[model samples]
Target: MGVWHRSLSRFFSPDEPHAAEPQVDQESNLHLEKPISEPLLKAISTNDLPTLRALLETQDRQLFSQIAQNGTPEAAAYLLSRHTVPEDYSQYIGSADPILHPTQYLIRESARYGNAPLFRYLLTQYPAIFSSQRWNNESILLSAMQGGVGIWRVILDYYPAWKDAEFAGHHGCVLEFLVDRDKKELIEFLLQEGLDTDRAGDPVLELARRRGAGKEVLDLIRKYGG
Candidate 1:
């Protein structure tokens, strides 16, 4: 598993039983260290634009990077208003700190939150960010699938490669991920987008069945069966 997947596995599958105690302790410690200043994070979370603007003016404007990861249109607009030239912006594009890469962070966050306008704005402003990879070389499409069908549609409309991109881990393709999550809308979307839901030896439908997926999922499988 990749670093991101390994770190998240415990929280996502807490009942799996392995080394829970130490992981819990580490998680607690990690949460104690607030990377973003409390006031700024609070302002972003509460959508207090005035407080956010004041914080940016008084505090280090560099802290504005935090808002890019917030996945809110307001935060995105504020960040865009302060856009530097492409030359200067390059410094932040691939920063070692993932959160500092405004475009990449915004793309991932927007996908996760189903914020099409924000995603579109970032794509228009920084098309190069789409070429960047996140954890395990996963594409923005994988992140969008994790959100829902709306996110998938908004991103796939602009970046069709997402449909074919396979995730690094056992999650496999977008179809498999949607099936595992029981995301009926995304499953249908992928099918409509030409995903071979009934490909030979593809266990996606079987897995969904074992998960006790409802009639919607079963009907999708039947409709698309080859």
Candidate 2:
């Protein structure tokens, strides 16, 4: 913890011309670089839930929104659930710029970890988050593929358009993602959804074959004659 504080102090040093004005601790006459905010950020980053809860009791609710910027999926879930509706923090909810907003990071992390509850909560609370895309126009569905099949299904159920969405990668759509990852259930799910794999010159099947997909996957592809 000492190392973390020291490292952060360097960036928030009073000498840094662009640093935000530091707050002074009345009793100790200590110049806190960012006052109570720094500790809250550190606690969230370190996953110190006890410390985070204690700080929250006294800190501003606005700081809770900042957790989405870099906090872990677990931390995001805890903070969001503990706080009331964050209507005041809407400005930082989601952004399309390369610089990731908290909501965008939360979405990506939730999908990456297959945290369906958190993903659902955030989606329900702030549907606008989906309107923004991450790097290379990556959608929440693309990120969810990295997690487990349950999360993938949840996202698909909530946002059907994701099945047809193309991410910035070799895999074009959900079908290709399931094939590449050898997710048989997801593949079957897409098949049931009437995904036409019979296109005469579909590149995904060829790509799947070249990538050494399992026989089951190849057979599924064959069934559709892709």
Candidate 3:
């Protein structure tokens, strides 16, 4: 994972109990003073690329910041097309405490929506941000797990070290998160990826049982000798 791989494109705070997740709504509150036109909001929410392009042509710097905060892969792709992402692209969006970088905001949004292409595109555009030590935290990977097995697989494919990364507080590992959420497919995937079920904090089978997981999940965990 150096500065530029030939496969180029193929690439928070533990305060509140749910701090491991991005407080999207709460964080958005910090940006209330920033003026974003309604049409831009609608285009971002509806993923109307043409409208976004038309609007972005003239808006000030705040435009990209707002897009980074709310837009998806479509908007990201388009924005990246116009601007050469700076090395310090991990910029602060709000001028308040507990501020999160726009890059983090975008990554969380990409993970939440399972937008692997957007994730990869951003990785290629800003390898410095993606490979930075500060960004490789547990909560970010937890967000990817929350996205589902598809994005989880994409993430691990790029950052293999996170295959067994531990999550802080509850849901110690991806295995535990999948079990708690009764994500059968992801459980099977992680088990096959060599996650030791018994070593993933608690006994996988028991945790699944306690979480009222279905027989399929239980059986999969047991098959891996959980």
Q: Go through the candidates in order and give the C-alpha RMSD of each one to the true structure.
A: 14.2, 13.2, 14.2
User: Against the hidden true structure, what lDDT does model 3 obtain?
Assistant: 0.58
Clashes of each: 0, 1, 1
lDDT of candidate 3 over 1-226, digit per residue (tens): 1111111212111332322332458554344334567888899999999999767654523434444333445556554555544325344211211122445556655665566666665655656655555335455566677666767777677777676766655536767677777777777887888876657355767877887888998888778887
TM-score of each: 0.57, 0.52, 0.56
Clashing pairs in 3: 11-120
lDDT of 3 at 6: 15
Task: Tell me the whole-model lDDT of each prediction, alpha carbons only.
Answer: 0.58, 0.57, 0.58
Pairing residues by index, what is the TM-score of model 3?
A: 0.56
Poorly placed runs, candidate 1 (over 4 Å): 1-77, 81-99, 134-139, 198-200
- Give the per-residue lDDT of model 1 (tens digit) for 1-226: 1232233323222232431444357665565432767888899999999998777665423333333333345556555555553332334232323333445556665666566566676777776565544342264665677667766666677777667666665557667667667888888877888776554464666766876778898789778763
Model 1, residue pairs in steric clash:
none
* Model 2 residue 75 CA deviation in Å: 7.4
Best model number under lDDT: 1
Q: What lDDT does model 1 reach?
A: 0.58
Candidate 1 TM-score versus the reference: 0.57
